[model samples]
Target: MKTSKGVKRRRVEKDGDAVVATKLRKEFGGLVAVSGLDLSIPKGTLYGMIGPNGSGKTTAIKMIVGRLRQTSGGARVLGEDSPLSARLADIGYMPQEMAIYTDLTVSENLQLFGSLYSMEREAYIKREEALLSMVDLSERRDSLVSQLSGGMKHRASLACAMIHDPEVLFLDEPTVGVDPELRVGFWQNFADLKARGKTIIITTHYMDEASRCDIVGMMRQGKLIAEGRPEELMERTSTSNLEDAFLEYSWRDSV
Candidate 1:
């Protein structure tokens, strides 16, 4: 691991991976939300999880991020047991729901999150400025989150998540209700993050967005039905696009 200006960089294991899960399972009473799911994400890469509404993408992310415990199996994030508080500073998570202070201004929300990580005033300000620009919310810095549009709120939430500059980011449907232009910007930022050596794990239902990921995992009924680069999966299924490839995999899984 390397350190810069008091920030700890990711520890590169011999395997050069940032996240690893084996047989990860989650159950809610009789309902298996996630079952026997496996994942291996490399450093400095964007990995996407694509599945329908009930496919357990959120459940799996919660387990991996330590917000929710798994019923069986385990995972290692940043080379530590999943969800270790000691490693919290190294990870950032953006849930499907907006997780921001509704009454606070965008800058205040970013400041609060930065304070949570004990960032210094100078560092927080610098990061806040950069993040606001990245999310295209620089002009709305002082606008109360409640007063912003849904798309603006979503962007603010993303800025809050990235304020700490975590090495690993877990984003669940980050572009849910955004317009096409903003969605394009979001993917562009994701690529920039990956270039900066950040490992991003994103869950999205959009086939077009999934195609931008370095690798993608398709899930169904709490199980991962297929995994590959979007083009590779398409080729394997003899399909022309990811949507068709995903449908083919879902059909195969059903049988």
Candidate 2:
């Protein structure tokens, strides 16, 4: 029943959760990037984390994905410790920044990721083709990443993240720079993945898109201000939209 920075703490347990955290905090020097985040995401859920920039969304993901060590607390993903030495192959992460190789063609990048996963040649080719089509890069497969536009690069990065059929996905601002039309397709893709039983966590700024998530968590100043089904959050605040609901939560947290 203890609290840190006004954020509640709970026992860290997976308990059928695809991702679970308790008192998850990250500090660089005296600044706490994540004050103390308690999170629980059930398996096969499409969870969205919404917040303004630097609200610790990316930092929290980095910690959960095992890319960065946390200052305190604990997290478990897919029943394993989050900071474990080896990342489970069943996890996929799409970071906010471009992570693909700039000098390689889109097809080549896919091949590289496939090889990393030790995929068979035939399976790799099949998955690569499907991913290319999904990201709308089938026509631009030969284009070098360096030559692709920002949005195109983003699409390529997403395709690469899903290359291995990971059961858990962490997408950080995945729709940034994406066209409105393409963004709709991306949401459909996410829905399809969820239907197939994947657990997804995404950080986004678009309140409209957040409203579409199965569960939405609003974050501010490194803490979760509110969380629930999008409709429920709006209903709790008596707000008509996610934006207004989030504003109400943020104001309450600040007071």
Candidate 3:
């Protein structure tokens, strides 16, 4: 698949360089949403970012996706500069809010998003059908998004985000309103993506879900307080779960 700019988009970049963020900072007036934060995500791994409200989770993602300008510092996606040109096809973003049109049916929304990349008609159908199946929304393809439940809408939104089969996926609180069963399914889907060598960066306040990540970055007051494998973080902080580890890290940071 290729973006409208004629950049060929692959399912996974062969020997793709992991994401790198160096001193990434974003400020708004007197408030610094992201403060000299640095991060790295390996290809084919699931990375989780967790923090309390206003800890810069969403702000960081917005900066990465080019929705907001950084006050200072820099970042790179797929080895290119932050907000790489014509790199939209290399990224699939699922925002916290459902970005799909409420009046459009699931299939219609998928088709519309597919057209955004100028995907070929037959190719679009294949990709759309595959995505709908992966999201378990095939049965509801003709249903209006407004009539679907919160979980269903979220699933639809996810499918639309990947309409172009991006190599890197940025999911901001993907499973927020999903039920436990659905959440588990979502994790399974993420694992599947990992198997295909897709780099995934997920942000959430959910501790339990953070455990599913290969590495977790705990953000505090617009800074990355700690980052490591889930078990490594727990052991280093002498805590049993990610939530407690985050609190322990925060207390130490304050000291």
Candidate 4:
């Protein structure tokens, strides 16, 4: 839990219990998307994935969630293979696109997804109320999704993902179209979830926001260029911010 003279440090456990990947790889025809990559996320930790477009960040996430089959690799989430029957109920996934039903009312949409996991109506009702209020959308409980603004739609999507109360949440670009004010609120919500022992893994292009992560994995061309706390990466790269540090790391990696 120590850092260099100019670096800030955050405490993260390096215990045996974690979400892990070893030699993870994916390919599409002649193209190799993710190649021999390894990642480990500790339980109850906040982890970030950062990279330029086409750097295989999305591919990596897809594999972790079992949406894409790996070409040659392996992954273990919460001590079991991802997509295994036992892990299905413990993982909540929020994709990059808004997955809400445009025609359904907020409550109806929640009920639809909630029921998919066999969540009882009574349990779903209780969670629905708490989640709706948490995201400041209680008044819109009966509004059709198409009536909400872009930010509100994102909020609704987040609520739907959490309705079943999964222990691990995978958010791919959760703040894409959110405004600054709402973005701040979103991070605050993430912090609250962390305090409650929920593990969050998110992918983002925003450098400033990436600093909020307990640990970050900077990726390039399907390979991990660096992995560490934000401040540790900055100090190691002799830079003041994540973007600059990423550039420095990429340069050194190429050399």
User: Residue-wise lDDT of candidate 2 within 126-173, one digit each (tens)?
Assistant: 899998998999999999999999999999999999999889999999
TM-score of 4: 0.90
lDDT scores for all predictions?
0.90, 0.91, 0.88, 0.87
The 10 consecutive residues of candidate 2 with the worst lDDT sum are 5-14
In angstroms, the error of model 1 at 156 is: 0.8
Off by over 4 Å in 4: 1-16
TM-score ranking from best candidate downward = 2, 1, 3, 4
Residue 124 Cα positional deviation in candidate 4, in Å, after optimal superposition: 2.3
By lDDT, the best candidate is 2
Clashes of each: 0, 0, 0, 0
- The model with the greater TM-score, 1 or 4, is 1
Residue-wise lDDT of candidate 3 within 144-240, one digit each (tens)? 9999999899989988888887889999888877788878888998999899999899998999999999999999999999999999999998899
Worst 10 residues of 4 by lDDT: 8-17
- Residues 32-92, candidate 1, lDDT per residue (tens digit)? 9999998888889899999999999999999999999999999888778986778889999
